[model samples]
Target: MKKLVLFVTMFIMVLPVRADEGMWFLMFIERLNHRDMQKMGLQLTAEEIYSINNHSLKDAIVQFDGGCTAEIVSKDGLVLTNHHCGYDAIAELSTPEANYLKNGFWAASRKDELKPKSLYVRFFVRMDDVSKRILSKVNDKMTEAEREKAINEEIALIEKENNEGGKYTVSVRSFFQGNEYYYFVYQDYTDVRLVGTPPESIGKFGGDTDNWEWPRHTGDFSMFRVYADKDGNPAEYSPENVPLKPKHYLPVSLNGVQENDFAMILGYPGRTNRWMPSGGIEQNVKYAYPAWVESSKLGMDKMKVHMDKNDKVRLDYASQYAGVANYWKNRQGMIDALTKHKTAATKAKAEAEFNKWANKPGNKEKYGNVIATLNNYYSKTNEKARHDNYLVGLLRTSAFAALPYSMGRGLDAYASADDAARQQILPQLQAAIDEYYGNLYEPLEKDVLAAQLKLYATKSTGYKIAPYVAKIGAEYNNDFKAFVDKAFETSIFTTKERLGEFILHPSLEVLKADPLYLLSNDLIAQYRAKSDEQAELDAEFSRAFRLLVQGMREANPDAKYYPDANSTLRLTYGKVRSLPKDKRNDAKVNYYTTMKGEVAKYKPNDEEFDLPKKLLEMYEKKDFGRYADKDGYMPVNFLTDNDITGGNSGSPVLNGKGELIGIAFDGNIEAMAGDVIFDKDLQRTINVDIRYVLWIIDKFSGAKHIVDEMTIVK
Candidate 1:
């Protein structure tokens, strides 16, 4: 009777409410979403979207570099993704003399393609529910630790069973706050090569100023090709490897989008905490994000100082600086939007209702304390959360702060090894050490580390601080420049030559005594330290939160529900839509932006908004060719109601007939709170229209052969 009630409750809860407000699993679309999608103009069947034994849309989508999404656009594995998604690889291949990032590069033929040392694209093969099998191993009486162990044992077996003798990678992911489980299988191709990109002025057009804001005119797309062995199996970089023959590739559409025209996006969205409680929301908005914003700005300011003076320094720190700036802006936006929306108060009201439902006679045992547990956990950890985020900022921006932890482990292994083992490890260790220093610009690094250390030490005052940092703070009065200078001068890890000598005569004593290593160890230990009582409370809180979700589903029987995103493939459908008219946008209609608006933002020789002379000349001459919209303007970027987040950076936005229309990249600033709560009115996905991508490749870059490889449908 109880099980039947739970089933009926879940069925009612999952009934569609808002059409544009979910990141839905592909596996559940047929039962839960297909009818609504069809009504909204999805011409493709659910089977056509995902099929294990057939060539389908799922075959074309891949997790790019384990972080972002990309799609195979040609039969020979020409992959399309956003420029920022390919930023690291592009930066790796760039040099001061022949800088591809400053001036875009297009491979004339397959022979000219450049490969990065480490880059991979993973194709999703299949997925299936394993909830029943895993859940059978745990019971209500079991502790969270025991429950975790039991589930992990089953997960390992399931992964091993499905791996098919090492041919595929398998992952068992928990969903619905551990209420369910599913296993995903994937195949990874490691030999992805860069084919083309726009110059930074176009690829990153508006830079930090225009990021996450609509009226966006950034041409934020890049191209790469996946290579495989002769049999079409994944392989490492080899001269003889050929472009992969993909199972399915999207047909690019020449027909432009109009308002209310049905649209959909598919990608691996990284994460969303839509199920997070009010206390957690309050903690992040009030405490954690503020620290993140401040620390990130500190790092960016210090890096930019040296980066502006030297081309080599700029090249070395470009990727890092861009990364820090993006999140710096994003966190501050979240703080503002959350505050503006009063998201915490809204969540609290809902929780108040849930608390009443939970305390009712029949529900008291399972859910009565769930809300209290969550509230207690958040309140206890608020200050620590702030402290941790500050530390996280340091870890992200300072190479030396993390280097001891990363490289010192190898040194420890060498110290303990026999003579033969030491010989085997020495070359690999030496190569890694050399690679570390090769990319590092020491003077800029010192400035960044000093600035970040000072910020972290001075600002992270709410709780116990890292002991070494505290000592340094007291000695230097919270300014770290002199200490960082002295440490850099004395630390063996500072240079490749010193590290090489230390490796020859490895000693645990020397590593322990090194000031840099000691500092790194102390920082890490402080972050991880927790009392036994706190650990118990955390465990109880985890169990209570999962029950809270389950109980909420039962209590709200008619409310809509979907699992939070966990870096898995999902499909979200909506339409090409517009918001209320705003003067910030140059578009007469708010749905799209054109080249004229982009050109208007340009400044002469400016880093963020500069335009190439050729581009400006072409725009002035009205030379967009066939890529222009029906209105005779060259569309740069467009807005849609499709749902997206961080990992959806390069997702393909498809029209009703499953034809590629645009590449989904950014989200509007007004809806920065979308991750915590979906706002149907304000949330919009900002995308670079496919036509703009083709215009740059065909007419501007003269890479017509590359465009010719695609399956274009008018």
Candidate 2:
């Protein structure tokens, strides 16, 4: 079969990498990587890095906003994370008259800190390997469904037993394709407040144009303070709450860095698919990612128009727009880099080798069919994945549909409730509807829905396309614009006033007759119809993947193996290094970018390149301050060979002494495919130098009081 050859080619061409590459678990650092890390300049003991019984580096890091990593910088719980990590909270606190997102925000004092309705930081309490306990319940003889159920049940029981009567949050995660399992315990603090942030010009400088590019100049950092009850225990936000006094915090290092300087990062890296097969990579590059890129660009285009026109809309949509635009560019890079590297072909060759090992007489029953099975399934479902992407993208852009879909559940509850219950719930429903309308803008939603609906009707097929969308298209003679016109003109969901009037006297009959409500239900139904089939296929793929990886590890027992990232705390270490250039690309890159370089990129009034007047004045005067490196130039950003992925944003980049020197924000463009395959020669971790963060705080923002809290060292 053609699939067999592709897999064969992929396996044969796979190359081994030598540069530092891994997101290693903390518990195994001593036995597995401490020696190698020391050879590369690690000065701390493995226990010093992640000891459970004593204060260590692990105590300083927290998972920020359930996604990114952040580090405590002061005894009073001041936390440092990437600017984009806190963008959503900043946007939430902004107003048209005093837009924090546009002008930036500073607390000035602890008393002035602004707390959001919901924001939390989680501390890493401990982690334990539970592979034997979990695998004791699962075996190769069981069917995929049975294996999954057994593992889930074992994980649930282990998690429940370890929670300590609901005092701490617990989770069990699989690593190395379920060959290993670990349980993590966490303590969550809810009363977190915004401390400060730079203006969009400084924080998000270079925007999409320089998002994942090198020679970077973005500040890309923000500050927040965690709070607790007077006794220093985690509690809900209240006026009586006080700043938390954490067990450990990182001291800022101003010693500066040079090429080959030791660098390490501690953070929660979200996810990586380094072990995925050639078939999977081919599908993502050829089918799935292209659709995602197109739809995301469409959504970003629509949002930018409305955001540029209105200040209020800009503040509300700033976070949403950045999030969409980030992935839009990332997906395009993935496609380009994967194709250029011949990634799929390389992976197929590797699969060929795996097949030979898997088909051995002793291993035939356990692993023989995994490659063939995965290839066959990928072939059959490639188009469906593309269709699903369009459908998901359409819903993402249709913001109005969310209100009806979400509120419809509330209304359904009301319809089924007794008279007493209705009296109790009506006011809550009213408040919900009011809040929804507060953020909704009819014209924006109408335009977005029109674009998405047109794309869906023309490009999608089978049960994937919502039936209501099809009906509207047919009625309007395939003119989605005209159909949108009618829907906006007559739909109750379009106007707050109309929706409010209906909400005053809620009933199931009125909702059933409403076009938007009916459409919401139809989309939900269509999405659910595909869920069961997808889950079945996913189970098959997961089981095959587990067997394949397990077998490979056995066949090559001497090889060094690290788990793929899964939003769990991990450590990666390497040295500051410049990327080696090739014939296809020869852009000269330095190990660091300076303030002069940042000013050089400036274009007055340009959204992505503009700098503050004060920044320019300071730069012109050469206000190097004490934070400047010995060369008399202030470092803005630098490069490292550290392996990292998405969730590693805002992670602390530390030196051998475990002192914070920079914050990892982005990765090099050539290494965009690093998530799927670690490239030794090309991959680099992009970091904002700690000196820049302190300069912005002390000189640019004039917030030295906050700076005084950090233990800065020369």
Candidate 3:
């Protein structure tokens, strides 16, 4: 352990600490980061935070639904996560008569707790450094493909040997752009159930307008309970299963946050590319994000028109709309923030410095041409990148093309099945088709498909189009609506009834002959052709990227280097603070927001700011209960400098004493560039104060039963 610490510390000894940057590996924290954290008021030791030999903080954290972080808060395995993390589950449970999304839901008792069809939480078992094992099987002389195959083989062997007969999910992930590797083992619990949630008016307060902005008052949290078998082991969901007895759970702290207080967050951060070259950043900003933003906006606009008018439609498409809107806003922020911060120019300057170092003395052989190679690849594929984005957007978001492709494979399967097998699987296939059409709106989709097809046919970003494009031009005179009208008239995928009629007497030839299916097949073929053309360039870029990351570290051995996040459990510590307010904005930035601010933003019947009448009465009465701070106001949300990204949503924000004070939810808009390059002065993590969460659960919702389950520290 000492030796490992020394090796990590040696690399970062001379590095300047810029706003306490780094998403550090837990295993190395005791030796490499404990002292710095302690100086910032950390009261827990590294082992106490992440010991494998004993139950520690690690046992409390979980990978929620394979995408977000969640933590156990009670002895009975009560899990806490972002409201958006549980959005799909809540939407699934919703109905026109009882919309849990509009009005909040609180399971009055354990029996009332609802489990979604599929929801799971994974607990981290352990992680191991397997760099030497992976690197031993390959040499520098090996081609990139050969090296990848050899490494994968080695990783499979390691995972197989350590799986303990499949009791845990084991896999290896590359870190620092494949300069290092680590193996992780996790045990998943599949019986997670929803316990409580506030309404969208609170949970999704401010909506898209306040999503990534500060002064946030959104009570963005939801609750769940993890269940286990009779013996307290992980098991499938069953009525007989009982709430799990967790190994450890966080003690919630009611102590309010102050300016510059110590803060820490631990979670599975999805991904970041702090080591990306300037050329890649430019390509994303200039080519990729614009198409993504435009397509997502168009999809959201169509969904909103239907959702606003019909309650059933709103419930059916709520989760999907939120997902699209989140990224639509995020991509815009990324483009604006990156360009505003001059990230590409900064990266270019640094790349030049690294290149200078690489060309000096003995470094040339190992690192030569890495920068130029990466730049050339990005430049050569710039137009193709935009074309691919536009194509993917049309196929994925444009349901006319998307549904056929998604359901076509299943149709083909049914066509090839024997009579006995077909009878057995027919019901399942019918159910799937029913589910797809249940949420689909043909009128809206037809318009969307027509618009996207017109764009695809007219766009000059790419060199080739799907084969069906020629037919649209030659036969329909480039009239996308005319082409769509004929396809919908003939394709079984246009309506659920048509699909059902075709399924009654399935034919492989007829299915293949359908215009929509042919279009789907043609789109796939075009995608494959483009992929094949770029295959070699992609490989070259990958090799160059690996070398670039390694060369940067070698060139600046004395600078601190933390591996980019790859959805692995990590700890990032810092302090509570606010960024300097932009001159263009009139509102003064505050470190924390309160219930007063939430009320101030309220609109009586507005979709984004509507407040429940009961809550409005409570607010008018100033009935904050016992959760109000010393100043006699209920806290809503706060800001922290703790380094975090997308997957860190719902991660516990801990005080120096290792007590949960808040839940990390979003990042500030000005620092959207942080994922590409950490901005010391701008980046800030937005968190929902735990006090606000508890207040909503206890006072507003009247679910004191939940308050009784937690270990509260006043």
**How many residue pairs clash in all the candidates, one count each?**
0, 9, 0
What residue runs in model 3 are displaced by over 4 Å at the alpha carbon? 1-16, 424-428, 528-533, 581-589
Residues 394-511, model 3: lDDT tens digits: 7766766767877888889898999898888788888888778887777777777777777766663465677787677668878988988888899989888888888888999989
Q: Which candidate do you rate higher for lDDT, 1 or 3?
A: 1
TM-score per candidate:
0.97, 0.95, 0.95
Candidate 1 least-lDDT 10 residues: 7-16
Model 3 / residue 582 / CA error / Å? 8.6
Which prediction has more favorable TM-score, 1 or 2?
1
Superposition TM-score, candidate 1 onto the true structure: 0.97
Q: Write the per-residue lDDT of candidate 1 for residues 125-229, one digit (tens) a residue.
A: 999999999999999999999999999999999999999999999999998789989999999999999999999899999899999998898999999999999
Residue 317, candidate 1: alpha-carbon lDDT: 88
Local accuracy of candidate 2 as per-residue lDDT tens digits, 1-714? 975665434433322345378888898899988998888888999989998899999999999999899999999999999999999999989999878887898898888999987789999999999999999998778887898799999999989998998988999998888889999999999999999999999999999999999878899999999999999889998989999999899999999888898899999999888888889889899888888888888888887889889998888778878888888888899999999998888778778778887898998888899999889879878888787777777777777655677887887788778889988988898788777777766777877878877776777763357778788878887787776777677766776787676666667787777777777777777666656777778788888888778877776676677878899999998999876533222223477888887888899999899999999999888886888878788789989999999989999999999999999999988888988988888899999999999999998899999999999988
